[model samples]
Target: MLLYCFTSARTGEVHESTARRASAREKTAKESDEDLEARVMAACYKVYKEDVPLFFFNIFTFFLPLASADYAFRDYSSAHKILDAAEAYNIDPLENNILEVIHFEDSIRDVPLFRPLSELQVTKSTGRSRGADVFRKEFASLGHRSGYTRNVTIRSCRRWALMQVDKNYSKTARMKFASYVSRDTHSKHYAHPLSEVEGLANYLGIESRNDHIQNRRGMGMHHNP
Candidate 1:
């Protein structure tokens, strides 16, 4: 609507308050725009059956690259019922598109169904997933379970703090903070390979937004829905 305000403005000048609130609203809208993809990526991770960090993991992980055009999420939302239509009070994603969502059933079962963003509240979880140990092991166990040299690589994440934050903490009481950063970084890096998830999408006959990128060139602009 903010974009439209300028396009439909009278002599291209809107009230100052309108301009201010519109800019804020645009930012808020952009934030809400991310909801669908975040869930889709979370769903991708869920299929992995591996544990992950809470909160930020749902919105971002190396698993789902939020690198697509803004319109891509809308495309998924339209077909897969990614957003609850009743509460979202939004238009249909497939209103004029050639592709219809075929991945989800009329009643979705595997993927989680979420309420509209307006009705949701964010909160921090006090506990990590039961699979966290498994996730950590996957990282440290990448090469070995630890045998001198292997121990160094696994402990390298912690040794990193000694040269960095540990020195400062040595003069204070903040060593734990450095440990937290290293643990979180390991989990964030390979939230399970992106290609693996995309491959799953292809196997399931779900048309992914990434497909648009590859096809857009060979088939021209309107080639994808």
Candidate 2:
């Protein structure tokens, strides 16, 4: 068997490339499972709860039926029975689940805009040792608002990951990110969009230790590529 190898041009690390490809494949597979579960749970939620066509299966699945004061979806056996009943009743699970889908979509759209780093006070309140932990808490707060739905895509979810590298991580992190993404223009998400960087700098209460405002905004710029 010939093992395929991919080499990263930046790092010249062949192993890292293979590991990344493997990780992507794993993530794709996991997403497929989530999609299926979302569909099935949506259908089950509809029958057990209301006739709402757009069904949103909460990330905390147990809460979906509880919202309707219905417990039919709670038991594994009962859930399977509901699926059979829906099929027997000739219910088009997808069409019948429209209301649920709509609500679910709405929840997805509520993902928070990136928080201003200056306004964040996770360290004072929680006594969390690391910035990553602080960011995780912030992300969790966002998740809770989305009803703990796992299907949502969030831009700021990884902000905590960046905070992990340095507790005092601020615009410097964005600059480093921009440089990293600039090297490979394909990864726009990894870097702060120009607007986000600007919005962050403008948030009222956030203190700026960096003397020059323009420097913070233009940290990644180089005279030449």
Please report the candidate that would top TM-score against the real structure. Answer: 1
Best candidate, lDDT: 2
Model 1 residue 125 distance off true place after TM-score fit, in angstroms: 16
Please list the C-alpha lDDT of all candidates, in the order they appear.
0.30, 0.33
For residues 1-225, what per-residue lDDT tens digits would candidate 2 score against the true structure? Answer: 001111111110111112234334454665553343211211122232234431333343544333323222323234444445445767555634442212222221211111125522322222111232343455556556756544222223233233233244555564474234343442344444433233454686575444353355444422222
After TM-score superposition, the amount by which residue 204's alpha carbon in candidate 2 deviates from its true location, in angstroms, is 42
Scored by Cα lDDT, where does model 1 land?
A: 0.30
- lDDT by residue for model 1 (1-225), tens: 121111212111211112233334444675444342222321221232222222123333321222111112323544123334323645543434422232322222222212233322212211112122333355455434432233223233333333334234442333244323354443354122222135656788886555553343223112111
Residues forming the 10-long window of minimal summed lDDT in candidate 2: 1-10
TM-score between candidate 2 and the true structure: 0.20
